[model samples]
Target: MSEQSVLFVEDDEALRFATVQALELAGLSVRAFAGAEAALAALPTDFDGVIVSDIRMPRIDGLQLLARVRALDKDLPVILVTGHGDVPMAVAALRDGAFDFLTKPFATDHLVAAIARALERRALVIENRRLRAALAAGETDSPLIGESAAMVRLRGAIERLATADLDVLVEGETGTGKELAALLLHRLGPRRARPFVAVDCTTLSEDGGAADLFGHAADSVAHTRLSRVGAVVASSGGTLLLDAVDDLSPAIQAALLRVIEEREVQPIGAERAEAVNLRVVATSRGDLAAAAAAGRFRGDLYHRLAITRLHLPPLREREHDRMLLFAAFVDQAREALARPDHAIGEAERHHVLAHGWPGNVRELRNYAFACVLAADDAPGEDRQDLPSRVAEFETRVIVDALRASAGNVVKAVELLGIPRKTLYYKLGRYGIDPDAFRRQGT
Candidate 1:
């Protein structure tokens, strides 16, 4: 295991010595600073450690240091040590973005627990930063390939929204590149340097109604009895992409609304809420208005999330973009498989253009990969027939998944192991009736 570092700041000599001794004994590398100024001067933005400081230090106190730290790294965890009477001050420190506070004269166990929590918070910050960096380097342009009017307009919207700090709600059919659009927005925005945390709300449900957006406290309890930090608390100073927000239960929706409204997240086991600066972006294939009307989603939350909505047009509507996207996917497939350039034959292009891509861009990419694999396998046969085989394989997978689920849309969705909306979109693409099984009373 890697060693955890801690920066301990306390004006009291005896208390500082005892605290450093305790931390060191707990297997932490301690950097003790007698005053806040000394600690603040040495702590840079790249310092990945927990900051334990007294709330009532002499010059440039804990709050000021916290403010300075926030300016440099918003996710750094700062634990404030306060006297018994300084509860109000501790609360103020929390509002000013302190991770957590411990009252003075507390037991060593209490202090150690606080430090452990701070370290956990620091680790999350580092992870989030790394993820954001990867996203920035990987996705700068619209992932959807097309030159049709709808595609042009969609890309324009993404470009325009990328410049602002506002929340975005992406509405599109399955495989319409909702995640891709979200990634483009994050890369294009000011918070590109920060993290982009994506959550699949559909997979997180407790008892069919209560869903854990952040992990449960009960799940985090251990033999040592320390509570682990949850995902919502982990993603600070960045974007949190909640996929399938439509699937979230009403209880989870209410909790989410509180986080967005307060700009803070209360971890499952923590007594206090940690202040966070997050840009929220939600995606859904269902009509949010209908969900709200049915009381499945909160009305206020819907309004809050839909501040700016971007709709992605389906593949059929973007006919002009299809050829461009197909060519782009072909090039990408070749590069991905380390194969030489292979042209799309005239017959293959005709078939591709004539057949409606119900799976949208993602479906096309899969087909392209299959074509490349097929071409590689054929030593002397005509490579031009590879596209048709790829298409056939794609169709087979779709049909098999549908058949396994007995035509039950929801069950088929589970069998396909894709998003509910994506499964529905594929059914539509293949001209399968979603309610066919229900109509037959099967």
Candidate 2:
């Protein structure tokens, strides 16, 4: 049997023949059996399709077959056909992980629709398993791994700006790899041999921050008696990274602006200012220009830092890079934890592509690590009950239908065996924009 072929088992010969014909007519490849034992015998451990069986079969019933299938592979999807009297038993089986249960007089369209969804999910499962296996032999050298147009442009800009001895402002949303961009600039520049200093502006104390950034003479203030070089002086010949510069207080901002303007630092309690060669790379999570205009930041400092600005693309904007990043993080996590290779689930892959990663790369990396740590865990890293799982599966099915139909609501309605109004309602509820799939297809 083909990998995508379905195994249909029913004790009633006429019903089994009729259902098999309906499935085949729906363009599915199915193998019909008169008993669960025969179907189980023919089932493959890596079956990439659904199993449909009657619940009231002699000896090996649908529930017993489902248990056996679960033993073989818990990921395998099993659909049971239950009579009116057996509805309660079918519900219990669903709690035990039955994929879907159809009533005895169920329409063939419903069965076909259920099978289509099952096959789509199974395909994702198989694909993820293949990717996991490939990860063991795969590797990436660059810290930035992406081939999207935005990423390509960013790379070219980085390469060009790396050699330019100019102060840079790296701006983006949180977790967009602003620091990584700064480091790349430093690494690819003439200042590669110098120490790269990174200071968290948010952590700097209001009173002691100046002393920390601009060096202090011995007995400077009451903090310490020993002489100390601050981050600026220590990074005189190197590149200094000011992280979350927007979070700095007004006093610290004024002090920093002076240091940038003079290209010199005067230690606290010192008599003379010392000249220094420096490259400053400041990162912000907000629009520095807007902040400056609003009087939240010094305009002079903003202009000086904005001479060479690099904005890292957020994860949502880097459409093609999502999977590349996810695969890399998965491999990295597996190696770090010394865990065996593991597959990502259908829902995880869906989330990777569909969800707007507000936290960008950082959020995706954390999710990948969590997935590696717990293979059976839900993609959201939370324990999901049956209803949540069902909802997730339903969403995946709708998305897949949209993709297959190239985002045409009419076409998707036909493919999903649902009303156009129902599809639209679900789309709204799930916040799925069909135009995205349309663009992808084109």
Best candidate (score: lDDT): 2
Lowest summed lDDT over 10 consecutive residues: which window, candidate 1? 380-389
State TM-scores per candidate. 0.52, 0.61
Locate the minimum summed-lDDT window of 10 residues in model 2: 133-142
lDDT of 2 by residue, 1-442 (tens): 2348888998888888888888888888999999988898888768788898888889898889999999999889898887532434755787888888766566788788888777877787777665555444443244777777777778788889889979999999999899999999899999999989999988899988888798888886795799889999888888999999998888888888889999998899898999878999999999999999999998888998899899888899987788878987988898999987666666778899999999999999999998888774434522356666555555766776777779998987876666788888989988999999999999
Q: Which one is best on TM-score?
A: 2
lDDT of 2 at 57: 84
Q: Give the poorly placed runs of model 2, Cα more than 4 Å off.
A: 1-24, 28-118, 125-141, 376-442
**Backbone clashes in model 2, listed as residue pairs:** none
- lDDT, candidate 2, at 70: 92
201-278 in candidate 1: lDDT tens per residue?
Answer: 878765522324554454434453545545565567778898988988777888789888898877665567778888
lDDT of 2 at 159: 81
Instruction: Please report, in order, the local distance difference test score of every candidate based on alpha carbons.
Output: 0.73, 0.83
